[model samples]
Structures are given as C-alpha cells and as structure tokens.
Target: MSSPQASPAASVRADVWLWAARFFKTRSLAKQAIDGGKVQLNDASCKPAKAVSVGDRLRIGRGEERLEVEVLGLSEQRGPAPQAQALYRESEASLAAREAAKAQRKLVGAMAPPMRPDKHARRELRRLKDSM
Candidate 1:
C-alpha cells in the first residue's frame, strides 16, 4: 500500500496526450496529424503511440499556425481548458513567431478586395475585358 500521490504515470501515448492537452479535438485527429507528419517529438517525427513524458519537446502544425511546446505534465483524460493548458508550456520563441505570423496575416487580409464588387466596379472590369 502506497500513497496515490507518490507515483504518477511516467509516460503516455503521443496521440492521447495531444488530445488530453487540447491540441486536437479528438484522439483520432491527433493520430491523423501524427501520421501526416504535422506533429514532431523532439524535432523528429513519431508514431501516434510514441511515448510522451515530461520535458519532451513537441512541434505541432495546424493549418497556418505552428506550435512548439514543452511537456509539463501528463494526462490521459480530456479535462477543462485550464487543466489542458497546464499540460504544456509553449516556448517564448514559438509565441513570438505566432504573433508575427498573425500580424502578417492581418496585413495581407487588409490588402484584399472586398468580398463583392459594386455594380460600377463590375462594369468597369467588364469594359476592360471587352476592350482586350
């Protein structure tokens, strides 16, 4: 007989940890990301069942956003957002890169034309095409 707090899990499956950490909505999604090479452990691609423990680094790519985080704790259960967030600590460099990318995206979005062209604008475009 021993105290419950005296021992904790030494490792968990990569996919399970990702889902538990809230990086992906579901374990299957995490598995897919791992298979697709969108997730890397310690700078190397790993299988979904790869073991993840504390202090290990993880790089996860989702859409245009990439995250690099250090594992702080281990959990196999999906919990509240706050609890999930506590499972990993993102590096400062990763945070800065994400912010810079977000700013760049905003600038690009500002330069894009509106969703719909006005009647006059459409006619001008048609006139240019007909002249060509």
Candidate 2:
C-alpha cells in the first residue's frame, strides 16, 4: 500500500512566507532579513522560524519597497504573482506610500547614458586610480 500523504502546513515560517510571497527571491535572504530587522511580525521583531498565521500583520522592506500587509492565506510553495497576491492584503496607506515613493524616485533620478565608456575612458580611470 502507498504511504499516507503528508498534510499541508496551516502556518508557515516567516522566512518561507516572505519567499513564497515573492518579497525575497531566496529563503536564505528572507532569513537574513528576519535576522537583520528588515521584516517584522505584528509590529514586533520575530525570528525566521516564527509561525505566521492568517490575519497577522507583517512589515517587509526591500530596497525602495516597504510593505505593510496582513496575511490572508497560507501556502508553503511559491506561486505566480496572481496566486501569490492572494496570500496577503496590502493596506491602503501602504499602497499609497509605495506609489508616492515610486513617483519621487522617478522625479529625482537621472537616466543612464547610451552606452559604456570607451577604452580610452577606462584607461584614464585606471591611471587615475593607480595614481591615487
């Protein structure tokens, strides 16, 4: 007879949730963030292995994006964006803040030049660095 199938998790670790929700690309990165205070649970610092349940609030920060979300569903496996979005609900204030930050960044940042510097420019930079 086939062995009994293992049941799915009702609550998952904080690191796993972050990766599954697409906040961090890898579980290790999620764990690092958890350790470094970039991620919080219910307004308090929590460990990477902390169990997160539905209705619990989370604060996640990555680069320019800062998210305050409430967990709505649980899944251990990562999924597509549409499916992942089902896992949490972002607050209206958080959405507004994110949009405002995006707009401000666009207004303040400059665009890149057409291409990389030529060989002469690279050589000049090398000479300057060596002289220093």
Candidate 3:
C-alpha cells in the first residue's frame, strides 16, 4: 500500500489538476484552455488528458494574466481556495510580471477616452474626417 505522502507523486489528468487547483471554475473550462493552447506542461503545449505529477511545471494563460507554477501536491477533488492553492507554487518572476502587467493596464485604461463621445465632439470628429 502507498503512503499518504506518496499520493502527491501520483499523476492526474491535466484538466483535472487544473480544476482541482482552482485555476478554472470547471473541468470543461480547463479542457477548453488546454485545447486552445493556453496551458503548457513542461514548457510545451499539452492536451487535457496529459498526466500531471508533482514537480511538473505548468504555464497557464488566463485572459491577460499568465502564470507559471510548479506542482507541489496533487488532488483530484476541488476544494477551498487555500487547499487549491496548495497544489502549486507560483514562481516569483511570474508574480512580478503579472503585477507589472496589471499596472500597465491600469495606466493605459486611465488614459483612454470615454466609451462614447459627446454630440459636439462627434460633430468635430466628423468635420475633421471630411477634411481628410
């Protein structure tokens, strides 16, 4: 019989692991991300059924955020946030990069114009376009 510590060394499906880790809300979303090449195993693209074991590296791209983590534990069941977080250890470099990206996005958003222009602004834009 295997010991409790040995369970972390066991392999689980890539999608299952992602879901269990709380990377995605559901297994289907994890599978979709894997299929779309948004997830990588060991620096290479992997399928949903790929075996994920402890110590394996994973790069997951979700929306504008990219995370690089190393598997530290394994669980097939989805649990609380703390438990899920225990599944992987994100790299310090990845955390810094994400924070920088977020700050850049915030700066850019602040500089962007409003969604809709006023009537006067629209008229001025139209006049400018007609002159071109």
Enumerate residue pairs that collide in model 3: none
Error of 3 at 111 (Å): 0.7
Query: lDDT per model, in order?
Result: 0.91, 0.86, 0.91
Q: Per-residue lDDT tens digits of candidate 2, residues 1-132? A: 321111166688899888888888999999999999999899999999999888899999888799999998786778788877888999999999999999888866656454687999999989999999
Can you rank all candidates by lDDT, best first? 3, 1, 2
By summed lDDT, the worst window of 10 consecutive residues in model 3 runs over 1-10
- Candidate 1 lDDT tens digits, 26-122: 9999999999999999999899999998999999999999999999888878878988888899999999999999999999999998889889999
**Least accurate 10 contiguous residues by lDDT in model 1:** 1-10
State the lDDT of candidate 3 residue by residue for 12-119, as single tens digits.
999999998999999999999999999999999899999998999999999999999999888888877988888799999999999999999999999998889889
Residue runs of model 1 more than 4 Å from their true location after superposition: 1-7, 118-132
- Which numbered prediction scores highest in TM-score against the true structure? 1
| TM-score between model 2 and native | 0.77
